[model samples]
Target chain A: MYGGGGGHYDGGGGAANANSLFGGGGFMPSQSTAAPESSGGGSLSKVGPERADAAAAHREADHGRGAASDDKSNFAINSVEVSTIRLVGRMLGKVERVTDVAFILDDGTGKIDVNRWENESSDTKEMADVNDGNYVIVNGGLKGFQGKRHVVAYSVRRVTNFNDITHHFLHCIYVHLELTKSNSRLPSQINASTGIPGHANQVRLPNNQATTFSASGNTAGNDVSSLVMSVFHDPAIIDREDGITVAYIIDRLKLPEEVIKEVMQKHIDDGNIYNTIDDLHYRSAMNG
Target chain B: MDTSSPAAIVNGEILNKFVGRRVRTVVQVQRNEGGMVFGQSTDGHQLTIKSAMDIPVSHFMEVYGIAEHNQTIRAEVCTDFGPNFDAKAFDGLCKLANDKFKHLFL
Candidate 1:
């Protein structure tokens, strides 16, 4: 979901915690969940690198390094307290240069900086991408700057229109915030064997998203506003078959004393027990 | 008998020395039959020093004058502390041999 190289820190304790978590990103790297979604890893309990291409690309990107990638989709989605991505249904905003070489991308939720490096020889790999005002997908961690949070896109792909886009692995608890704004129809189904888009259908939530995620009834969405975690596109989940099952890991998080029993039993019974501060808020909203 | 123990060991090259309680005297340099983790040559990828024991430490080394710790080539006495070097610009110029950041002994 993000590389840990950039040093972004804010004054508050929460911000410091966030910065530290991302700083040590290489310590415990995660390969994108895209791989298994692409390959026909039909078994519900099993999830591994889905495709050889994805696995190879991911392995190379994360080679000998911890936590490096544009698509740290699975856990990062449920983790970041506040995050946003603009792949579609959004207008390109101002592209202000924060540093001599880098710029910050601002979508609705917040802005993310396009971090540059001293050792990196050229902006060639960076500037070759699409500019602001056009829709693009950014994959990186949220960083605190002068006063706002920004993303450092490891890679960017321009999006002309949402309708033309197909084959997305929307693996977050809540998938709506992916677009800066979207009037287009959301994806609803996944072909288990091919990992490709099957049909144009709409669910309360988008496909590839965990069932526990809900905009209205979500308990996790309460504590924070929009309560977004990390967001990125999974290159896997293309046309495939066998079967794909969504497993919930948040069910394992231990909640406060008051709600421990309900959470544990519900979790054991396959009831939703979200893992993050944002998740807690949304779940509470759903409950009330 | 193997007189190697009383000598200074670095990168597997044994520098046979006149043994002393605090310092050892340089005699002759001999390459090791065993490998260690540090070995390098100029203008090439770093050499891997394979050791049956511990991996090598520190990528850089320097020998310095005992007084100011300025790197100097002339050291009649030597210890694991090195020739006594400071972080001065003259830091790396003090090797009895090449100080090209390579293992002389591994």
Candidate 2:
């Protein structure tokens, strides 16, 4: 997937996997043509009872965390929820061995060591030029040997687009929030329809009752929800389609972070507003 | 826990903190060996998993591990899922993603 990134776009292939994090952003018009039939039946029925048990456990853990507990998946890269991480950062240092390459990468937030096991290929010669201070993206599995966290990079490439680093950070966060907050917490109404975990499934809200942010007997909660939504109306914040981060919402609403988190969670549960780019950032589901 | 900001951290950032502590996080499998697995967050941050039995990726799992440097995590406990994806919990995510990433889509 790493090496094919460039050629995949050039080939203009019909995206069989439209849900691909990197490829199928709204940027492409072909996304709608992705196979919708797969979104349906037989596959879900097979999982049966096992799926239910997992659902219960996931909810239990989430509820136990209560409202707004940093929810570790909050970071973008951390949120991809994969066993392997693909990181793009500046190389702080490097140590090259006959059979492997190791480098320390500082992505500004933190630093981690990346180790690349060299296979006999012409590619090994190309890596020799990857000296310290070179900005490169490393894709590898996480390995811990001798009490240290290291990225075992299977592929490392120099990033030609400088903006891609910043974009990668934001994109990682965006996808993570979308996956963790919005994707994992589907309303029961919608959950009943599709058996697959949140893949383009829609919860049919009651007829024409698009604005479901009703007074669910919690006036304060409803007020905060409205306030949260109102901020998007401000051209400045809403203008950036990425939506506003929870921090920005906290600043503008002048509400306690916990209170804001609780309100936001409630809205997501009730389907009032949906997480836009990332869970920390959000926008109204009305448009969705 | 302070809720003032999003306390998001990469698995690497928190590895040292969990060295001797009992910590829990949701993990997805990338590879499996008899009684051990290479797992990561849904986002692909890596961690090691050790168990008495070979656990496949199909099982949705929540793992508790004692963070160690050499192995990162020795899976002390695991909760399994019969199905891979949790639809009820993730529908909002799919709906939000229905449209590609676009400002107007919001």
Candidate 3:
């Protein structure tokens, strides 16, 4: 039954062969069950248990660094293992070499050198339009040689919209927080199933519901603005005559004070909320 | 060349935390006086930016350099963010980058 080259094994013959090999009594139960299936036969059912045992042994061996021993260089930042990174920054300087082109990038946070290999293809002109002071997005792998770190770029493209710069920084922060803090925030079922550490693809939020702010109509439901609004629109706080205090909102949200204040200001500007009783307290404008 | 220290994104309020360290901020240029630029931070605090070059007034400017004081920055690099820039959004980003999600950046 386990033979290659499409050779068919006769079921009754295979069962008799197994019984003779295993002395009959010990292998009888599985062979009897396998007899009904003419094509698979006793040998196929007999190998199933062995295959599972081998797989478990292989997994155990892999866990002990027998196979993945060379993965020690998978460096982590904020506990998230980084392989490829997307960065938005301004090109500070550039140099063309025989085999590759190197660029210095400053993304306000810090500076790093990006190296793009040159090949005998039309794509050699990839960095042709890029100039100093131009904002560009780089997709690359972070590499370290002789204790110095740099990026080996796969693709580099100029950023036309300034908002992308903002988005990139925010995205980096979001990803870092998600990977590091997800254990506390995510459900236990998700954590158990997604046991692989530092894999971003496995991280899933409990709710993907996009709550739109009535005032802007553009804000995503999962953003800070919507979160703040949800607290106000809660059944308990929605009908309070005096509205909610900033301290109360701060207590419930667990966000930074400056972040909540900024969100509140934005909501007020968008006409979603208004000051109630005093400047420190606020009520949802949509309540009335 | 000094990639060891990364600039922390800050607004008016978070500036105090990174004094004497490299930091970046976006502000609306209120006026340019001699070599110094007076601006309003995204969070509405007044800031004094010391730049060698003249920066245009009434435009949004992103300054990156060492934070000398709570409301001052010694500008190493300054970029114009154009006339119309979203201060509110930038302010929110500053708070998020510095306060809640600071580990990602610095």
Candidate topping lDDT: 3
Predicted candidate 1 versus true structure: per-residue lDDT over A145-234, tens digit per residue: 443323443334444322111111111101212211111223322112112132213221222232213221333422211111111112
Worst 10 residues of 3 chain A by lDDT: A51-60
lDDT of 2 by residue, A1-288 (tens): 111111111012113222222211111000011112222211111000110001000010111111112322111111111223455556766888889888876443245677777785634754675777666655444443443445566556654444334334333324232223332333443223222223213333210111212221332322565456445434344346676777988887688999998867655543334455664677643332
lDDT of 1 at A129: 46
Best model per DockQ: 3
List lDDT for all candidates, in order: 0.23, 0.40, 0.52
Residue-wise C-alpha lDDT for candidate 1, range B55-95, written one tens digit per residue: 22432221111111111122322212122222121212112
| Clash count, candidate 1 | 47
Give the better candidate number (2 or 3) by DockQ.
3
Candidate 2 share of real interface contacts: 0.00
Global Cα lDDT for candidate 3: 0.52
Q: Would you estimate the TM-scores of all the predictions?
A: 0.22, 0.31, 0.52
Give the runs in model 2 whose Cα sits over 4 Å from its true position.
A1-81, A186-288, B1-106
The global Cα lDDT (0 to 1) of model 2 is 0.40
Which ten contiguous residues of candidate 1 chain B have the minimum total lDDT? B63-72
Query: Scoring each candidate complex against the real one, what DockQ results?
Result: 0.02, 0.03, 0.16
> A172-252, model 3: which lDDT tens digit per residue?
443333333422333443323321233224222211110121312332324567667667756567778788988998898
